[model samples]
Target chain A: MSGAPATIKDIARLLGISVSTVSRALKDHPDISADTKEKVNETARRLNYRPNALALGLKSSKSNTIGVIIPEIVHFFFSSVISGIEDAAYETGYNVMVCQTNEMYERETMVAKALLDHRVDGVLVSVAKTSTKFDHLTLLQDNGIPLVFFDRVCAFIETDAVVVDDYKGAYMASEHLISVGCRNIVHLSAPENLLIGKLRKVGYCRALEDNNLQVDPYNIYLCDTSEKVEEKIGRILDRHPRPDGFFAVNDSTAIAVIQHIKKAGLKVPEDIAVVGFGDGPVATICSPTLTTIEQNGYEIGYEAMRFLLDRINKGITAIVARKKVFAPVLVKRESTARRFENR
Target chain B: MSGAPATIKDIARLLGISVSTVSRALKDHPDISADTKEKVNETARRLNYRPNALALGLKSSKSNTIGVIIPEIVHFFFSSVISGIEDAAYETGYNVMVCQTNEMYERETMVAKALLDHRVDGVLVSVAKTSTKFDHLTLLQDNGIPLVFFDRVCAFIETDAVVVDDYKGAYMASEHLISVGCRNIVHLSAPENLLIGKLRKVGYCRALEDNNLQVDPYNIYLCDTSEKVEEKIGRILDRHPRPDGFFAVNDSTAIAVIQHIKKAGLKVPEDIAVVGFGDGPVATICSPTLTTIEQNGYEIGYEAMRFLLDRINKGITAIVARKKVFAPVLVKRESTARRFENR
Candidate 1:
C-alpha cells in the first residue's frame, strides 16, 4: 500500500500506451483522443491520484517554506521567540522548517548551506553563541535568498534585525540598585564577543559614572554563559569585601548569585542587593524573587518574522535593512526590595 | 531579483526552440543534438537553476518531510520532546515542520488538516490537553499517512503511542509520602477525561488502601493545569483539617501547594509533607524543593520518533499499533525531608 504515487509510467504500463500519451490524456490535451482521455481520467480517479504539489514547485522552484535556524529550542527565551514565529508564519500562509544547531559553529554552517541547497524562499536566524564566521550567511546572500537575524546576530554582515534595548535595560538595572542606596556594586558580565555583552557592560559603566561613582575595572568581571557562574561569583566575593550590590547579565546568573550569596551566610537585599536582566518566569519563581528587565520575547519573535516576510516580499535589493529595537521594562521584585541597613 | 527559477520555457525562449525540445536537451535525449544539450546545460548553469526536489517528489510522491504537532513549545517538557524529535529526524534524513496548537482543540484540528493538505510523508503528534474529539487524527489514518501519538494521546484512536508509567509513578509518590509517616493525605489530580488522570487517581487510591488507610472520595480534587492551584488548595484546606500529606499531579501544582502552605503559616516537611510528578526544573528552584517523579522527556521524545519512523518505513498495512510505557523515577528533595515525630 505504501509505494510511489501513480506516475505517468504506471498509467502507461496499465493502459499499454506511451508515457507521453498518458500524461497528455490526463491533462485533457486536444491531441489526446476522447476514448484515451476517458480511460486515463477514470483510472486516475480510481487510483486516488492527487497530483503532487512538489511537481508544481519543481516547475516554479518556489517551496513556500521559510527556513528557521536557532541556537536551541529548549531554552526559555528562544522557545518563546519560536512561538511568535509560528504564529506570524501561520497568518502569512507559510510553513516553517526548523533546524537546531545546539549552539555549535560547525552545525550552524552545515545547516545554513543545506538550507541554501534546499532553495528555501527566505531564512530567519539567531546565530549560535560560538559562531564568529560570516561566510555561510554570505552564501545565502549569494543565492538571492532573503536573510533576517534576530537576537544573537552577526555585525560583520549587514541585514535587517530585531533586538531589545540591552544597553538601556542594563542601565536601568544598575540605576535601580543605586536608587536603593547601593554603592560598591559588582557587575557580572558576558564575554565581549557578543554585542549584547559589550552593550550591557557599557551601560553599567556609564550608569556608575553618571552617578559620580568611580567605575572600577576590577568590579566588572567577565563571565561565560557556559562556564560555572556561581564559582566565578564566589571567587570574586572571596577576594573583595561582599559588594553591597550585584547586577547580573541575566536572571539565571542573578539567581545563581543569590543562591551563592545565601550559601555564604548573606541575606538578599539585606546584607547584599541584586538585580538581573531578562525578566523570565524564573524571576518570579525564585525565592526572594528576581528584580530584572523584561524583554518581551513574544513581541521580539513576532516583529522578527514580520520583518523577514517583508524583506522577502520587498526583494533583497529593495530591502533597506532596517534594525528595529524595543525598550526593556524594569520589574522590581523582592531580590532588591529595600535600602541596605548600613547605607 | 526575487523571481521564479528558470524553467524549460526560459531555455526554449532563449534558444528559439520548443519547450519540449529544451526539456529533451536537458535530459540528454539521443534525438537532441550535442549542440542543443551543451546550450541548455550552459544556460542552466548560468541561471543557477535547481530542479525542485518537490517536483521529483511529485513524480514519486515522497516529500521526506514529517509534520510534528505539539501543544506548545515554550513548555519545558514539550520543548524537550521537540529537541529529541529534531535530533532523531535529522538522523533519518527527514525534515520536521512544526505546528503549535497552544492547547486549543479547534486549532489542533485545523493544523491537522493543514498538515494533511501539505501531504506530509508521515506525522507525529502529542495532542493538546484540550483535545477530546479525534476526527482530525482519524482523517490522517483514512488518508493512508502514518500517524503516531506521544505523551498526551487520543484514547479512541488505534495508533502507535509512547507513554510513561503514570500509575506506578503516582503509586510511588503516595508510597513515599506514606513511608515518611504521612496519613490523612489529599490528592490533587487532572480532569478525569484524560486517561492519565484516571490512572493516577487509581494508583493513589490503591496505595492508600493497601496501607489500611481510609480512601475518602472527598480527598480527590479535580484541577486544571491552567487554573489557580493556590486558590484550589487553600479552599480545600480551609473546610477540612489540614492533611498530613499531599500528592500533586505535577511539579507546578506541587510548588503552588508549597507556596500556599508557606503563606498559611505551615512549614513543608515539618507540617504537611508533599510529593509531585514531573521532576521539572521548577521542582529544584522552588524553596523547600519539591520531591517528585521524573519521567525522561528526552527519552520519551526519542522513542516516539523511532516508533513513528518504524511505522512510516513498514507502510500502513504492517503497522500493528502499540503503546510503549516507561517507568518513572522518584527524586527526593527538601519537600519530603523529615519523618513525622508522631510516628
Candidate 2:
C-alpha cells in the first residue's frame, strides 16, 4: 500500500538521531532536550510522518478497531445503528470496519472469518435472518474475540446484547387497534429465524387473547419469501369477514398494506387501521402517518458498542454476559387514531 | 488482537513440515509434490489456518482493502452507493473501511489521515458539503494510492470519477415547472462547497434564461449553518408576488418546501408546485408525490467502483483520469404533473 507511510525511523534518519530519541522528542518526553525536540518535530513535519498503525498494533496486540456486522446497511434501521456506532467509536479513539450480510447467513460466516483475519480487537454483530446455525458467530468467542449482538440477536449465543422489547411493542400495536374498535386484526410476519418476527407474532396473539378475542391462525399470515405478499394480503382481506385492522412487522410492509387498503376503496382508520414497527422516516411519509412501535436504533448501537468495549477492555471471560433491552414506545399518529385524537 | 489468526508456522507445526514446504505446497509449487500439498491442505483446514493478512501485505505491498469515505451513511442516496460498493468489493476480494465525515471539513481531514495511516490499497470517496479544501484528498494520489471520487465530486482533482449530471438534472426540473406555466421559480441550495448545489443553481438560472424569464436573486436562498431554512422559506412565500414553483437541491428540502407552502394555505400545482432531485423512495411517500430528476445511484456507484478498480489494478499513473457523467431523467409524479397525467 505505497510502501508504508513516513515513520519515526525516517525522521530519526533525517535528523541524524536514534529512533528512541526521535520518538521521545515527538512525544515531548522530559528525557529529550528542548532543542532536539524542536529539531525532531521540524524533520517529522517535513517528512509528512504518521505513526504506523500496524506497528502500534504489533506492539500492543490491539488494533483499536472494532468490527461491526449488520444485516444490511441500505436499510434505514441498520444505518441509524451504524451512525450510533460511529459516534461512540469516534469518542473512544477506535475505528469501525463494517460488514453487511444483506440478510444472508453464508455471507455472515464469510465476513466473520474475514473480520477475524483482520485481527479486530472485538466484534459487534446483528445476526442475519438466516443465521439459524451460529457456529460462525460463536467462533469469535471460541478464539477469545469479544462479541456483542444487537437488535436481530440470538438468545442462545451466550453473549452481551442490546434489544428492544419486541413482544411489548407488538402488543401495544394490536391493542391500539382493538381500542379503536377493530375486531378482526391481521398480523403479517416472517418466520422464527428472525426472533423479532416471532416475538411480534406472539405478542399480537397474546393481545387478542388478553382482550377476550379469538387468536385465529387464519388471521396470522406468514409473509416470508413465499411470493405474492400483495396477493396473500388481498385474499386475506377478501375472506368471509374482512379484517378491520393490520399490524405489520416493519414500515415498508405497513405502507404496502395501507396502499392495498386504499385500493379496496377503504379509508384508513375509518375502515382499517394499520400500525408498523421500527418507526423509521417511512412511517411519517406514508399517507395517514402510520402509528408504529419505535425502536431507538441509535441507542441500541450506542449500548452495543459500550457492551463490546467493556468486554474487549475487561477480559471477556471475567465479565458477565448481559441482555440489555430497551422498551419500545408506541408513537400515536393518524393511521390508528380513528376514535382518538389524531396528533 | 489474539495474536492474529493461524499462520503458516501453525500449519507447519501441525503437519510436521518445514515452513518453506508448507508455503510452497500451499502455493502448489512444482518443487513441492502433490502428496505434501494434500497433507498441508488437510492440516490447514483442521487448524482453521488463514494466511495472516499483515504478513501477506508485507510480502506483496497490497492490503486488499479500499477505504471509502462519505459525507453521511445514514442517508438513502449514500447508503445505496454503499450497497453497490459492497457488491463490487465482495466480487473483487477486497474489503472496505467506511468513514463518515458528517459534512464536517475537520472530520474529513481526520478521516483521510486515518485511512492513509491504515495503508489501504486505494480510496473511494464522495466529498462532503464542507470539503472545500482538496489537499486532504490529493495526499492519497501524491503518495501513490489510487483515489476515486463519486457523486459529490471535485473537478479540480485529477482522478477518475463517476457523477450524475446535476446541472442537467436541475435544468430539467426547472424547465418542467416552466412548461407547467409557472412564472416565478425559487431555488433552494447550499453553498458552493458542495459542487452539486452550485451546479444545480447554475442550471436553474440557465433554464430561466432559456424560458425568457428573469432570474431574480431574491428567489435563491442559501441554507447553511448560519440560518433557519423554515423562516427563510416562509419569508420568500410572503413576498408580494410569491414564487409559483420551487426546485430544491434534494428531496428533503423539497419536502420541507411543500410543507411550508401547505401551511401558507397555498394549494399545490394550482397555487405552487415543486420538484426535487434524487428520486428516492421519499419522493413517492410524500404527499403530492415529488416529481424529481432520477439519478441512477446504483449505476453511479457501480461505475465508480469499476473505474476505481481499473485504476487500482492498472496503476493510477498509467491511466488518464476520466470523468464519467450520467444523465438524469425527470420522473413524472404528482408534484410537477399539473398538465401531465399523474400516477
Candidate-wise lDDT, in order? 0.81, 0.83
User: DockQ for all models, in order?
Assistant: 0.35, 0.48
In candidate 1, list every pair of residues with a backbone clash. A54-B54
Model 1 chain A scores worst on lDDT over the 10 consecutive residues at A48-57
lDDT of 1 by residue, B1-343 (tens): 3455556677778878898887788788999999889988998777655555565556555677888899898878888888888889877877778899998899888778776655788888988778888977877777778888887877888888898888999999998898898887899998676777878899999999999888988889886452567558768768566688889988777888888888889899888898988887777777888999997778888888899888878886587888889888899999999955555
- Per-residue lDDT for B1-343 in model 2, tens only? 3334577988888778899999999888999888999999988876677665655664566777788889888888898888888878877887888888898889988888887777778898988887778888877776678999998888788888888899999999999999888888888876776778789999999999998999999888885321345768768888879888988888878877777777788877778889888888878887888989897776777788898889888987878888999988999888876764232
Off by over 4 Å in 2: A1-4, A28-31, A224-228, A340-343, B1-4, B224-228, B340-343
- Model 1, runs deviating above 4 Å: A1-53, A224-227, A340-343, B1-51, B341-343
Chain B alone, TM-score, model 1: 0.87
What does chain B score (TM) in every candidate?
0.87, 0.95
For each candidate in turn, give its C-alpha RMSD to the true structure in angstroms: 5.8, 3.0
Question: Per-residue error at A283 for model 2, in Å?
Answer: 1.5
